[model samples]
Target: MARPDSQLLPLGDFKPSDEWQTHVNAIFYGIKGPEIHHHFQTYVSRDYRLAHALADTFLEEVRKQRLADDTITIQEWGVGNGNLAARFLSRLKSVDAAVYSHIHYTLCDYSEEILNGVRVNPNLQEHEGRYFLKQVNAETQDDFEPHSVHKIISNEIWDDLATSVLLQNNGMLYEEFLQPLLQRNIPNVPWESFVEQFAGKDLDALKKNPPFLEQIVWERSFQRIDISDWPYGTFILKHLDRLADEIPIPINTGAFQTLERAKQLLAENNLGYTSFDYGMLSDHELNLPGRPYYKLYGGQYTSMVNFPLIAEVGKAIGFADVQLEHQHDFVGRNLSENVLSALELVQVHPRISRMEPWDADLLMLQTLQALNASYRSPYKGQMDYPPMPGTPKKQRKQITELARNLSATGVPDTVAYITESEVAESTGRLKKLGYGERDLKNAFDRSTQPIAFGHMTLR
Candidate 1:
């Protein structure tokens, strides 16, 4: 049912989009809490490949810096569901108990609800006294002294940070501002109720009335302004001046601040800050016309992290060097194998996408069965693949059996990282599924796109 247009509720006066973007995202995460995973997946889920890879990379550095009786402090920003921390710590312990003993892990997030959810994780219970949780906003919080921490890490948090969209056209600059409107009326809920609740940061009220969130509508306008007074404004403008006109550029102001704060927290000889996220990697990519700069997921505003700009900011903040590369490359370097993401491997079966939905699911399970032989994960985590509602009894039974027999080490169906040797070992089964050695090798080919999933480090 549509409300009369006149009764629509408008949220907050129009200003820079990030101000409202950050506010709305806070409301989303605060209301949904850890249950936000149902809306999107992180690399930590399905398998522990990324966490293990990260742990392996950090292990070498930890070994080099392990002086007698010194505690190695590591902080993970945006610790969701605590899975990454659990797996990283577990891997570190399994491989080298001595180094793990010197570890003091801290999980930091802005939402108390998220921190509370992480506190009760059964995995964290096993590492009792080794880790603690801190409620700190990545953008502005400076809870630690300068050069106090050893290493800082975050995954997929940058895109959600406050970002403003800017457009350069005909020798002028403009900032995008958004006005969020309720697309329709909710039964017995007045516009005033929403305005009050949103302004008050009333998570309880917003959680109870979920429908209001589903109806959010954004109206956009651009205002020309001088950004000389804004934080890092001059640096951002200089970067933007090099890009093509009429293309919107995402200025990751929040991400820049995170780097600044990370510089302060990291020790002089620290391993420094490492972040894994998806975004633009080069100026050529940002200069392309009609490129998307931001997207909305589950009513939360998210922008690409703008890696090129972020790299420049990291260097400007006095980091010795900045390293930017694809996430697969980073994982591969640590594991000493040519790594390919699960999605990339699935692309080897060209006809899979053209098949019926259920047929595709069956084929996917079959593919996983083949890869399960050699893609064993040291971490034991459950991954289920129940068939669709209308699956035939025989096919359903097959899927059930495959899922049950899924190796405790089976490759994840979505984002699992697999090496070339692991794929080579599964050649017989892969051939049966119409994937040969050549196809498998080609899956690891690096993508040339400007914006893709990547990792970055500041040291």
Candidate 2:
């Protein structure tokens, strides 16, 4: 098969195929519904330290505050699959069963499907009497009661929140671009005509909107791909311009105004919240040189990191304290080294072969640099592998032999790979983005294994 084009594809015809939609829906709702769970799980498991540390810290904070008691209520704004919530509950149960015995959980998400999935977890079945799952949009007030929640947690949810402006831009441009295509009803429209009519117009419109335009130009540019019948390419180019036009400008009065409103809501309720995701220079972290999270997926430069604008609004709204806690501590020390090492030595080696139904599937993902440096595959390889017949014994024997060899040499496969020119290219990209040798070393050290984060709670 032809290599899957990595370039920016047109959103005009970008309706998710049924299978893709299922994947997206499963993720959006936080349901560990097959494909979606596997997609995120590989990275999370490999980065186990990062996941556990964040969850541990958040739960520890709640524990320290003595909020595990029945009277204290915790609500997760974008509680996906209740993973973090489950972890928090487990920790509380371990510390003092009574404290967790009757604790109330309000799990909220935008998708009803996710909310429903939360309601059905077997682990949660015993505690079903104490939990509530609701569909909520963070921008609106109807879904939650004011000043009622003691702690709010969200993980990896804010970045995807559909802002009115984003939707408006998408809807408007989609309508405009599609009108021509739909009118023609041919397989495609002329590339140049599509660009002139939609792409140029959208950019012009954005330029006119000084605030949003400044945000796009100054903040960051997203990944762009060039397609060459690519009438669809031209159409998508127009769509992207529209999307870029929708990005809210930073350092502007209008931007501040929206932030001010968000702050008002947080203050009005006096709620304590924590958010976990990738971003640089948060509203809480002023004057610090912002770091990019992932160079791929639009996080190329310092500005590409998705700033916690909502959390900023919350602080502005008058919360006592607002901060962006780094996941690096977890990512580096705990995930890359400790937790993953433990799993490798214990669970994976001894139990995997003997077990009939293996507990977990494992897969590897290259870092952004590694991916970019390597030959791009048309198919993004599965991050998780399913159990195959008669393979356990062979796999176990191979693993044992590999381990014995590694023990003698004391060198990892990743270390060997890093010596290559391709790895050098990846390391160079990382260095250019402010990552030091230590960072690269940590990345390389952890590359061979899979990592998992325990949970993420956003408030």
Candidate 3:
């Protein structure tokens, strides 16, 4: 139920000044500039609570294993800003001081520039002796030793871990609506012929401009691949070239071959890894088809990258104890309910609680009109008068008349008229929807929340 204000700028308005870009670079690299680090905390801390919670849960499990005294080596993949690592360590320290006494943490990211920035955080100085930061891509697993780390943690990192272009051409509706476009893209090719050529291989022909390609190569799909066997981070790129020409749709043989190669590479080691992000499940569990949570800011889709599938690949590679722990059902429900409740409060209309049939139409309309006028400009384009240049007198008069009519409708009091009932029915409705009075109070409190580094801090 964390309600962090969105840090997104309006679409098309993102022009980063040189100074700001430098600041962003510093933060992404993990250099500790207070200004940049503060902004990172403001934006990322909202979603990173999951990582913190997961770390806490993992630590609890480790304790049950009676390894508190033994060095707990944690490797965080894609540690942008190192915020998750910091938070996890902080929580661990708070929960079990003994565990913190003998822990080693390795933070890794792809960008050396960002990693340099990450090393500057004053907070990290406390753990300087025990912590290590690396400029390495998870796909390469470059200098990391096999089976060295006890636990691997990542948050929203798997979706971009390894890239692939996903061609979604299934479902009856999709075929009906989009198949024609797909057909048009192929030059006089039969559906079967097309499927045979591209089914599992990289669509090199479509690289110039894949008609249905949603994102660029770097920004394409990401699915977690198990490297528990071959090496901790070895990844072989699997090019999914597909064609759709004949019955049973000819899938490119190269795609499966590439997958097999990846499996072989991952079969060389034993590793324990866990990734958490919003994703859809392929299995039929409670009829919930998994879906990616697209970042509107980045215009990218991030999926869960099915750990079970990755585990199967691991098994194929000769790794054992590949457990796919999906804590989604428990956490997703709470997060979804919190988000829905906030949205409901924003859209709730005051007039929906009318007991009488007559109260639904005329009075409600007038009330809505008045509220709309006050919120949206009643006189947008009207000429400015002498006293109030931009104000529209006609619209103002209409609003006044509406107000008078509402008053004449025998509403008891102005406060009662607006709120609709004692304790406010909207508040009651919000509570029922899982938003407590505390949540409402917090929303109001955000307006007064102090600004630090151009971001609001609730506390």
- Per-prediction tally of clashes: 0, 25, 41
Clashes of 2: 25
- How well does each candidate superpose onto the true structure, as a TM-score? 0.89, 0.46, 0.44
What tens digits encode model 2's per-residue C-alpha lDDT throughout 1-459?
A: 533332222323332122222222333243222223433432222222233444456456656765555465666666555655654565556655666675677777666655666666555565655677777665344544445666565565443442111112433422111111222212134534543433333432222321211111111222222333332234333334423333331211122232332343332322356555444334323223332222211211111223444344444445546554344334444334322222232232233455444222221111332324542322122122334445477565543443333222221221111222333455655454444555434443433111122222223
Question: Lowest summed-lDDT stretch of 10 residues in model 1?
Answer: 182-191
lDDT of each: 0.81, 0.38, 0.38
The number of the candidate with the highest lDDT is: 1
Q: Write the per-residue lDDT of candidate 3 for residues 1-459, one digit (tens) a residue.
A: 423332211111222121222222222233222223332222123223344455566676677767676777777766655656665676677777788878788887766645665687554565666689977656544465544566666554544333222222332111100011132233335444544433332244323333322221221222222322422222221211122211111111122232333333221221345554433232322113232322221212232243333443455555445444334332333234221111123323343454233333333334333333222211122111121223356645554455454322232222111221212435554454344566454442213111101100000
- TM-score winner: 1
Comparing 1 with 2 on lDDT, the higher-scoring candidate is 1
| lDDT for model 1 | 0.81
Q: What local lDDT score does residue 64 receive in model 2, on the 0 to 100 scale?
A: 71
Ranking by TM-score: 1, 2, 3
lDDT of 1 by residue, 1-459 (tens): 654754666777787888888988898788777777656677875557788888988988776866325888899998888988998999999998988898899999999888888888898789998899999999999788788789899998999998989898898999999888874356245667868888788888877674555467888999997888987777888898788888888988889889989988988769989999988888878887777788787777789878988988788888878999888877788788898766667777767768776677777777777888767666666666678779888888887887788777677545677788888888889888887677777877775655687889889
Task: List candidate 1 stretches off by more than 4 Å.
Answer: 1-9, 66-68, 186-188, 211-215, 352-363, 384-405, 431-439
